[model samples]
Target: MARNKYDIDEALDSEFNIKHLKRLGTYISPFRKDMAITILLMLTSSALGMLVPIFFMKIIDDFIPNKNIAGIVGVCFLLLVINIINMINLRLKVNITAKLGQNIIHQIRSDIFTHLQELPFSYYDDRPHGKIQVRVVNYVNSLSDLLSNGIVNTITDLFSLFFIVGFMLSIDIRLTGICMIGLPVLMALIFFIKRKQRVAWQIQSNKSSNLNAYIAESINGIRVTQSFVRERENIQIFNNLSKSYSTSWMNAVRYNFMLWPAIDNIATLTTAAIYVLGVSWITNGVAGITTGVLIAFTSYIGRFWAPINTLASFYNSLLTAMSYLERIFETIDEEVTVKDNEGATEMPPIVGDVEFRDVTFSYEDGVPILNGVSFHVKPGETYAIVGPTGAGKSTIINLISRFYNLDSGELFIDGIDINSVTIKSLRKQMGVMLQDSFIFSGTIMDNIRYGNMEASNEEVVAAAKTVCAHDFIMGLENGYDTEVNERGSRLSAGQRQLISFARALLADPKILILDEATSSIDTETEILLQEGLAKLLAGRTSFIIAHRLSTIKNSDKIMYVDGGQIIELGNHDELMALEGKYYDLYMSQYDFLR
Candidate 1:
């Protein structure tokens, strides 16, 4: 079944595969000693437990019948000792497995988060942030129970089944066969329910993810919604998503709740059959059919079905947890498309000379964003790029940052091919300020310090002053120490951009990119920031993208980009003299102002 939802769940392999089990060995491998001890403890406790019913049978048959009080008391003491041993085994098992489970969870979470860090921008560009957050936080937590107790209990139960069956068959082959009737029935029930249950849970997972994605998006865009008077419409959409989630959840749990009753019914019917047949056969003076033996056989029947019940419950739990694991591992297994190539080296000291030779690229295959465009920028020069929206202007800055690999041609930095160096080293030498300035939840001092962690507070203050942010920041009650929330909602748009300027310049990068850096500020503030911009750009190669022609008229050189290629390239004065596309663009803005 498919639902009309924003988050489309990827198809999972519904068929049960042993590979999932094998894959678990990677995490469990670290705590092999702990696992071995936990399994041994489980088996030992189960063994001790199996002997209880037998001892009870002995008391009824051999001890009380012969008036042997001493034997009864002796067996009673042994049972107490066995109980104590079982308790100890359980305590140890919980301690070891609990610790092991936590460690495994940490490792798996760390691995996913680490992989996410290495994954290219394109990975996140295609998915919602909330969907990614759920996998990292929710899906990993779901594995806790299965990792903690399910594995050991499953192994111990399987062994106990064998031991119990052997003891039963030795007591009476005919009765044992009668008890065996329920095993196939239980298996058949699971066989029928397994696929439906898995599919139901998978759909539930999809709905949950969709609901989370929508909630996150809604919260982030609440300001827009309120301003546009879309609150009622948004609430209606949210209600629909909530209802869908509730329905899918109930459907999944329907299959989950069905197992216990069916298993119990089969066990109840099997036990009743045994009692009727045993009593009738004994009345006919059947050979080797003593009262004690009949009692013991019934006792073993209860023992036999208990594990089957547990296995049934665990089987259900396994199928449910695997739905979550499928997503978790799928994320872990997502290939790091833009990572350090083999034997990639640290980038050498940058001189800011940048060149793109016949470079081609596309966010989607066959839908090219940049078509074989090429350019060269000399060190210490400031270049401004002007273009209409979707004309691949920002794509150039991103290419220079090496956030994306070229689709075909080569991009070189300081005459070195970009792909030959490690990404961390490459990015460290350049500073980029995007249109949206994201602030972490911390003191303003900490936010600016994020650029260069080793910079002293004095350095941070110096950078803030250079960006014209110091006057407003000092105007606050706490000055640089004032706390700000993530996304910087407390700060004005212009103030945030000023802080962003401080952050970008704090790194003292050789190459700097400012994409619409001053668009949000008024002309008066923009004029003040230009002095700070002059200081920051001294001896550094800079690329500025802006629609306001007044801001970039004095750029060392300007390139009017359009239709996936450069249409005009010259200094501001030269471009104005050419009276081509650049002149038309500048004249239109000038005419509007005039």
Candidate 2:
């Protein structure tokens, strides 16, 4: 649970257009076989329906006039048979598209989540976490039906419109011309609403993202809010986001609902004109426009408009999906700034030796976190980094782990450039214990096993024991099997750190990074942890960032970092003897305590 960088009211642009259709088509490509089958079935169903009106015309003109009872009964049976086939086709289409829709949703969401895992920390630092979650969950779900049913339905409807119009013209060209008078009106209405409706829906989507982001941030910071008695302020912020969403939603829906009524009215007027004109020609005894032909022609008019109405709904769904897909693609398209280079190989066994030559890096351009800073640690040595707030102490550990590529420089492990190896292989051999140690919701044993998935239960317990966590864990009612919620609410902050320390230890890494990992532990617990760690990491290379004097006093070297450079470096006594930055920092703490 972490708060976002910006306010919830932050506005977003509506970039929804036809461009995302190409990316969406790629997802649909894998299931083209199912789509082909669905299309064939739907067209067959439409063809079957089209035959019914013609059969009725035969009964009206020939069967009933001659008192041919068998012909009328046979036509009824044939229509019934046609309807049963259409029903069967409808059922099969539903089955295929249902599975198709879910599979596509699964694949798209999996791709988005996988890309998120590969994204650098800087990508996350720039956006709200909830925004990313929405793309995977909400945005993908909203487009599922559109990708499946809406697509196939629109295709069949377009083909159906063609067949109906062709039949109408065959009956009587004059009557067909009258029926088509509404086509331009329907097209004009759709064109006029297209951009406005898409923009409205896009606004609604942004508001929804904002509301969800704020809700997630509020839940994470509930303790802080309650501590400061700011419940009323949070409620006000939520209400404002919700109101914006509601307004945009109403506007989009108003435009959406407008299409149906306008289309229905146009169809109604056109059908009336067809009835009047067709009957007038038949009554006048015009050639090729008999009573049977007039009846069949009017039926085709209904069939023609039916698909037109449905096509409008499909257009609405497609536009809605376009707005959502824009956000989803934005996340999927984010660059992986720290990925491996071409021909990168798996990192060979990491030795303790590490070096950074003329390294320069930054979180933001023109604002260096570490500039031209260089350091080297010998095998089996411990080095501590000490610095003021905003100094580059944490950046050193981050660079060691290769979380971000250096803006300009070379970082080597055991004399081999780190950029020459696969990121997974590089990180696998290291253990990092950060200040904010996240404990997922599960049994304590499960949490520890996460560090080493292949570790036996005995190994997990041994690591816990080495970190002085076994005593407290065994003291719990269920021992190591006790369930803990996320952030380890059941355990104290110090206990959580002990469990995290045990997790990191279980990795058995050659290079260990502890970034303020002991800050939460009590004096007594810290002392016990230090005793265990001294023996455990004796032969390993370890980097410890600590403010507590006792924690780093025995390090082989200590560096005082400030203004993006290591201003002072030496062993503890040697640095204190120089009366430099390290001495002043240590003496200040010493004075504060005394």
Candidate 3:
């Protein structure tokens, strides 16, 4: 069994880029009408909010000084109306943006899943399941705020800043000049902090993926851990992963918290400067400077910093979200390595003739698993492949199914190159059963019906009966309806294999490939399985990979393979007469049986 290793030191080169936003915009484009309405509402709300400080300024400079009761009452009423409208706009904007954000997330997640299905098997061979799951679930979820509040609030804050600045400069350019001193410094500080925060957040995100991968791998192999009495070691490993994740998160938090104090200190110092300079200017007999103007200047300054604080928060969030965005787009941009050629046609129903011509394959460069191998099988032929472990028996079946593209040469079915046909059409007519015998979490009926979704209940039971699985299934508490837990942990290995056999048989495939299909079965069950398999193999072309010599004795032809090359090809009696490699292997097993 291959162990899943979690490598935390892997380098992720996910620099923030504008093109990521452009690609993300495609998902958002579908809801452009709703987003437009949201933008309009946000603008209206910010415009109304900016007017409130002006109302206060007016009451101090005009209504209070004139002692006009009607003016005060009228201004208060107008302020109330503007505030009510602002509240309404804010509520509507939240509704629109929230729904639009969720919809965009749905579209993005759907696209990622669809793309994952199209990706070749080779892509998955190099990645961990948990890491991919994190991208689909956790990473995509991290974008919720960026799509909702980030876009809306950033726009609102920018407009509010523009309006607040215009109002402040109109009141007193001198006071505004004092307030403006900190603006450049604050912006520069934000820019500097953003760079550090981005790196911290990227590290944190990577740590999160590492943690998820570790947990998933540990849980999947909990049985092995317990079997070896290594639970303590596993727990220690988990603790290490958790500690690293927490440390990275705290580092990011430390950098993020730095932003708030920096912005606040600048705002505070600017306010203090305004008060000191304004008092000095007024007391020194400056012309056209009054108490009301001074009061309004303070009010404008308060309004000014509020948006700055909001923008600061938004910037921090964008930095964090950019890390997730980079990861998500990275997965989305992965190429589908195995795809039909241009103008490829749908494969017609197979007559079960498979041929490999000068096939060469390798998982990596310069390490060939299959080197220039060629063979042909006619329709309804039972071809058994007997090989030592790692002799490329399974690779032959994987190539026939088009799971991975060949590095060179051609594989054909009924004279049509497998690569030249649509993958779905080519794979639909083939049934494969591997040694692992994986069973999903579902009732026995559903598991069997998976091979043919349109198969009726009676047809499923019939397939089960044909595989000698009906007897054991009926003995269960709920018969076909009995629930199988995850990976069929509730069932024995032989039972899972039988269920998988039933699934493959239900498909009624034209070509069947059994890679150690009966490895888990006992002698008694094997006898019954062979009886049913004889009937099943009557008219279909089949390939069987087996280590047990007894299983392939009755096969029409047995090809003995070793070191990626065929050493002998004949029926059992003919190979025994030759006394070659196959004869020695058979006699060893024969003596072991005796």
Candidate 4:
């Protein structure tokens, strides 16, 4: 499945989408005041830039021709002042736009993260973790260039283009006409190149996501890879993914680099044509053809193409950013499959009576994992569920916690429909510990206190003692303060399980779930841990899923499940007396138990 996810091609939508642009604009709406000031600054800077060429024209046609030293000096001073103002406005514009861009990206990243948290577990079940991480971190960051400089600079370039065109037309309409012969050609080239660039960029982004996903998966399974001596195979896979990413990047960059030279060639050719035509007209003594006018027109030609070149570059960047925007919005616009319904209220403290009324469920496909399963447990009862590997034991626990919604029936806790109450309220009263206990990178104390943030240091210690974790914890160099490296890599499996027990105990939940909780511990350790668990489960309703049947022998009710159906339900002695499926399972492990 991971390979398939990595192999999927990222197809781009339209090259330049106005809808995506408008949606992006909504992020900037909150900082309108900053954006407005930026726009004003951009206009002022561009206007000043346009005026500098006009001043050059004035020096050539008016001040220099009139032999007016005082006029030339005054014009020079005025040009200097204009340039100073332009520089100031440019600086302020950059500062404001950068801040605005960062803020908008920050908000977008935050929204994506918050929304991801609200999505159903099924959403994650169908996606790769690294792919989602890329969208939140890399794709959103790609918008910074476009937001910070692309929009404002593109507008400024347009203004400069117009101002230069108007000034040239006012000077000599004939020359202006000749200089613009390359305009249509340049526009066509840009349009053609933009489409290809968009496709290339989309491919590049997809490859990057694939590479990241592979890296994340590889790093997570490095131990397994090494243990199986498959390092060479993993390296080969990584190299292939990296090569693909590099190829896509090169393709995108080829189009980007292609545009600049294309624009430059056109600009250069147009400038040469203007100079030749202006000189010929002057030699032929055509009307309105002066040396000053010719020189100024030459200067205006450079200014004209400068903005055109800038706009063309901005167009390329805009296309690339549009691709990133499409990916980002795709994630942000995903419908949250699970959420609180309207008028849903918080549930009061639970009494731990859980009931499943003919609950049926499946994953993405409609093949039922739990079909017409019905059960009920009274408050403060310990219900043990024993089953084969895929016989729906854990599915029952998931349903009781409302991690998933029922397909055909209802689940109730303390007589209240679970779906009728807020998810937060429903989950707050339940504590769960699974077989693959996850330990975060933090001090042992912090990891334990994670179950109850408000737990004091004393409470944390007490909980650790209750779970038989305090003795080993105290033996460590830092005791409770010992940092468990990422996923508790420094600790043994049994040590991690003990800490998980402490975390669940800290919560003081009304209901508890232990899924193979003692499977990793040795018999000696399991015996001590069971002592702690006995006290922990004394008053709370508990569900235990265990392959080691002895761990659940004391459960008030033991259920043997097979093929998503409860085959036997009785106490330990009663099930043994029946000599049915339960008896056979026990007999198979009888030698080990003895």
Report the number of the highest-lDDT candidate: 2
Q: What residue runs in model 4 are displaced by over 4 Å at the alpha carbon?
A: 1-4, 10-17
lDDT of 4 by residue, 1-594 (tens): 243375565554544679988988888789888887887887777777766666777788888878989988988898889888988998899899899889999998998898888888777777777888889999999888887887778877887788889988989999899888888988788777767888889989989988888788888888999999999998898899899999999999899888778778888898888888888988999999988888888888888888888887888888888778888888888887666778889989999899988888887466888878888999999999997888889989988877777788988899998888999998889998977789999999999999999999999999989878889999999999998898899999989988998898799999999888888888887888788888889889999999998898999999998887788999899999999998999888987777
Could you tell me how far off, in angstroms, the CA of residue 84 lies in candidate 3 after the best superposition? 2.9
lDDT order of candidates, best first?
2, 1, 3, 4
Clashing pairs in 2: none
Residue lDDT tens for model 3, 1-594: 022456554466656787877887788788888877887887787777777766777787788888988988988898889888988888888888888889888888998889998998888887778888898999999899888878777777888789889988888888888898988888788777777899999989888988888888888888998999999988898899889899999999898888778878988899998888788888997875677778778888888888888888888888898888888877888988899889999999999999989998998889988888888899999999987888888888889999998999999899999878899998889888888888999899999989899999999999988888999999999999999998999999989988998899889999998988888889998998888999999999999998987888989889887776677888999999999988999999999999
Candidate 1 clashing pairs, residues 3+ apart or interchain: none
Residue 578 shift from truth in candidate 4, angstroms: 1.9
lDDT by residue (1-594, candidate 1, tens digit) is 123235466567656666776787799899988999998998888888778777887888899899999999999999999989999999999999899999999999999999898888788887888788878988888889888888878888999998898888878898999998887887887889888998998888888887888888899999999999999999998898888889999999999888888878888898899899889888998886767778988988888988877887788788888888888888888888888889999999999998889988899888898888888989999999998899999999998888888899999989999999999999999888887887888889988888889999999999999888899999988999999988899999988888887888898899999999998888887898888788778899999999998988878989998888888898999999999999999989999999
Q: Could you give candidate 2's per-residue lDDT for residues 1-594 as a string of tens digits?
A: 123643543344646556689888898899999999999999999988888779978988999899999999999898889889999999999999999999999999999999999999888777787777777999999988897699999999999998888777777788888887888988898889989988888878877787788888898889899999999999998898888889988998899999889888988898887778777877898788878887887788889888988898998998888788888887788788899999999999988899989999998889999989998999889999998988998889999999888999899999989999999998999999987888999999999988899999999999999999999999999998999998898889889998999999999999999989788888898888889999988989999999887789999999999999989999999999999899999999999989
Query: What's the TM-score of each model vs. the native?
Result: 0.94, 0.95, 0.95, 0.95
Model 2: per-residue Cα lDDT at residue 466: 92
In terms of lDDT, the poorest run of 10 residues in model 3 is 1-10
Residue 78's C-alpha lDDT in candidate 3? 86
Q: Give me the displacement of residue 117 in model 1, in angstroms.
A: 0.7
Query: Which stretch of 10 consecutive residues in model 2 shows the poorest summed lDDT?
Result: 1-10
Candidate 1 residue 160 C-alpha distance from true site, Å: 1.8
